[model samples]
Target chain A: MTQPSEKALVPFVSVDNMMRLVHHIGLEEMLKDLADYVEEDFRRWELFDKTPRVASHSDVGVIELMPTSDGEAYGFKYVNGHPKNTAEGLQTVTAFGLLADVYTGYPVLLTEMTILTALRTAATSAMAAKYLAPKGADTMAMIGNGAQSEFQTLAMKAIIGLKTVRLYDKDPAATAKCAENLKNSGLTVVSCASPQEAIEGAHILTTCTADKQYATILSDNMVGSGVHINAIGGDCPGKTELAKGILERSDVFVEFPPQTRIEGEIQQMPEDFAVTELWQVISGIKQGRTDARQTTLFDSVGFAIEDFSALRYVRDKVAQTPFHEDLDMLADPDDPRDLFGMVQRAKP
Target chain B: MTQPSEKALVPFVSVDNMMRLVHHIGLEEMLKDLADYVEEDFRRWELFDKTPRVASHSDVGVIELMPTSDGEAYGFKYVNGHPKNTAEGLQTVTAFGLLADVYTGYPVLLTEMTILTALRTAATSAMAAKYLAPKGADTMAMIGNGAQSEFQTLAMKAIIGLKTVRLYDKDPAATAKCAENLKNSGLTVVSCASPQEAIEGAHILTTCTADKQYATILSDNMVGSGVHINAIGGDCPGKTELAKGILERSDVFVEFPPQTRIEGEIQQMPEDFAVTELWQVISGIKQGRTDARQTTLFDSVGFAIEDFSALRYVRDKVAQTPFHEDLDMLADPDDPRDLFGMVQRAKP
Candidate 1:
């Protein structure tokens, strides 16, 4: 039987390759590059075909398919979130994604997105902080120092010139892990005993606890008037990290309103609560950080466009690189109608 | 960095491996096995999580993600349909699928489903015919003999004891290719000039034309009483095969009404049009082929559960076999909360 052609092959970046790719391009530089891609896609967000992620919720966790297309390329991520997984020695979130050409409906790249999701989620937070954080902001209060804390702190350092990260988690071991991971990353990592102490003198307050219930990791009293809140953990319904009072006091910015209304911290807010679309803010059609004393909150639920940007970034960077292996994922018959003949010829 | 643990590896069946596996098991035998799986799943269809496939349609083609879970395992197929692709020497339809453990949210198997889809689609049609087709049915009129024709014929032969296949296509070359491919498959092959001629002595008529627009391949007058119609071509909004009159004459059976109502031959019917769920018949809740002179139509748009069944079948069949390779598709950090540490340790 003849070998499959190039068109039939899809470049797959494994977790090992993804980590190698991250190191190949310095981690700090890669985070900044990803932030740029996220910002770029947000600028033209109207062109994307957006849909609320289709999710299958079970008693244990949730599996979701987030899909979006830009008329030229289509991308989607298959991600599962099981908060109980961490107790079982597994990552709470594991993901992989595919990018396909819109013209031919053929996959061009397939890659593990577990590491990429961490990078993109943090980069998106940092990018939002770039616009919403106070001018000359350099300190961030990193609450819930877990898997995402190090990336979040490093992204802030790379994108917004953050010089210090104040880390605090209910589990001190998690805070220690985040602090140790970022110790040599050029940021002054300070381990704090409490969330209140972590927010001291910080310009950005980021919360990313992994509890599956509505836990108030941050209260209204803990947040200062001018500090920007990057809330990334309240991604699913009933999984919020901030108190409802905190949401009422700030101007909430969201990815997609219909989705954010269901999954973001705004799920606690009334349906009529006013919020700004982040794309409009990025495009300069709407205001962002107008006053030094006004609180600006990025109620991020990690939209599909962000993942599309990340997928596109990896696809472009992996071109002609050793970071990917081609898998014969598509069937390419000499005659499109002779698929049976192709299979018959491969009788070995 | 240390090597990823077993939990991070996913078994992947490439196209070559898939073809080898098919040949290893014998195509006819494998088709029969797949039919049994499809039928087995159909019996418990109500236990599945069903949703209309998430589709992203562009001017030229469409990309879709069909996902479902049966409480224990989650499965999804990434498929695309670009009718113009055949002109560029590419298959009009291509697919790949993944099956993940619902408990850990970790993928167990990933496989190229282009060939598998052909096999499962045919198997599903034959499985439906087992319950809907007349007893002692021997000949099948295979119309629009393209990529799916030969599989449909073989599946019918293997699952329903079909002895002869009469082929017809708008393009004679397609019919010729299908006949040539099936010449050695033990079934008597008959090539015909018209669709009418193909059905002269056939007990079952299968239409699988490739047109993206509504083109009636079978008029009402051409469909005789008591003959079973297996329509597998009209899978999108503007695509269909059989005439509206034929649907009116036949008792239509569908996989999922919400999906088939928009993509199947029933799309031409009213929103309130009467149709039976094929699963009900499989579970013995509804009658199949009620009378000798009653027409039965299986409007198969292809559902997520069927793909789920096919994925389960492959994962089971490929176990302890050399038909698949392990893919490092997920990131398994030693400490679930120390993903950054994992990446940092991998800096080579």
Candidate 2:
């Protein structure tokens, strides 16, 4: 069979190559770089074409397609959320993404976004924290330690100059796993038996529990004044970590309003509940963390633009690097209208 | 880097392998088989989860994602339509698709869909003609002889026992090329200079011109009663082939009403224009070709379910065949919550 032309080939970064990339670029440094990319895109969020993710819900799980375009390049991520997957020894969420040229409608990059989504989610959380967290914050109470716990801690450390991480999970084994993963890191790691104990002396609180229910991981009394709450776990409908009373007390910030209202912690609130758009803060159009005594909460539900930013960052980083391999993923006939002839000639 | 596990590996069929598979199972036979698959899916159309394709239109072209799901499997195709690309010696349309297991949320197959799309489009057109075309119809007039012309002709011949194809294109070179390509397909081929001459003595008239305008390719006077009109061009808004008068005189059959209303030839008609859903006819819930004197028009805009059937068919065909390669596209860790640990352990 004849080999496809160069234009027909697309660069693919596999899971192994993605891990190699993280180590090669240094996990902390990459986290910091991804944070910068996410911030840059967020700062100019108006130029993007955004839509709430298209989701297919079934009896067991939900599959979603998150797509966005920045005029020049179009990107989308195929992700699935199945909380029960962990019981079957599978990640609760697994994803991959594609970036295509808008002019020619050809794919430029395809990569495993499971690890990238993990990295970008952390980067986004840390980016939000940079603007919403209390000034000179040094410690973050990490609640519900799971797959996202380590990345969140590292991103906070890399982006916000954090000095300490206090970890807590209902499952002691999960907390042990998280603490062991970050044992050698520069930050101080403290394991606590309860959520209340983890919040001691912590200026920022990060919750990332993975349960598909409306159970509250943080009560109104558990959260104090003058601190930042980074709520990343309460993403989908029927899933939330903080009580409605906490939302009433805290000035909430969100990524996209249309999506956040449906999937974020704000789902517990009424339709008229007001929340500040996070992009306005990043763009300097709106105020963030107005006063030291005012509580602030960053409701993160994972947006398509963040994934677009990660795709753009990876596309630029993999250039002339050994981390990607080209796959013949498109058909390019010498004569544009001779596709059938091209196939007919490949007979063997 | 450590090799990914079997669960992380997704089977991928490249362009070369797709062409090889088509030839391995003769093109004509494959077309016939694809028709059966398409018809079978249409018979059970109510079970599918359908949506109008999510399209992002740019000034120069449009990129679309068509997604659908059965109870057990989910599939989507990423396709782009850039008519200007042909002038650059590139395909006007390029596509790739994915199929995933709904239960696991893990991708089962990924394949190049440009060739498969052409095959499926033709098969779908032929499948529609099986119920709508007049009995003993053997001669077809194939207008707009471009990339899809040969497949359209061959599919008609293979599915409905078409005996002769009269080809005509505004570009004589396109008609010449299509005529030469189908010369040895066991059908008598004729090259005509004008649309009038092409439709002479023909029982099926197929129009597939590629102009992104609402220009008429077939007028009311050019079409006669008792013939099947297969209009595959004029898809998308602002694109239509037959004049409104022709549609007024015929019984139109469509794949999905909401989509065809926006992208099919019926776009020229009023919002309440009467049309029959082809799936209804396939399932024996509605009538088709009630009388030989009744004019029948099959407005083909293509649907996600047809692509789903094609993806399912390809997944089954490539199972034990050497027509596919494994892609390490997913990240699976030993402990589902230990994704960070998986990446950390891969540091080398």
The TM-score leader among the candidates is 2
Give the TM-score (vs. native) of candidate 1. 0.98
lDDT of 1 by residue, A56-105 (tens): 88888889999999899999999999988988888889999999999999
DockQ for all models: 0.83, 0.86
Name the runs in model 1 displaced over 4 angstroms: none
Q: Which residue pairs overlap in candidate 2's backbone?
A: none
Error of 2 at B106 (Å): 1.2
Which regions of candidate 2 are displaced past 4 Å? none
True contacts kept of each: 0.86, 0.88
Model 2 is docked with a DockQ of 0.86
- What digit string (tens of lDDT, one per residue) describes model 2 on residues B169-263? 99999998998999999999999999999999999999999999998899989998999999999788999999999999999999999999999
Worst 10 residues of 2 chain B by lDDT: B51-60
For residues A1-348, write the lDDT of model 2, one tens digit per residue: 778999999999999999988998999999999999999999889999996788988999999999999999999999999888888877788899999999999999999999999999999999999999999999999998998999999999999999999999999999999999999999899999999999999999999998889988999899999999999999999999999999999999999999999999999999889999999999999999989998999999999999999999999998768999999999998988888889888888
**Each model's TM-score, in the order given?**
0.98, 0.99
Interface RMSD of each: 1.0, 0.9
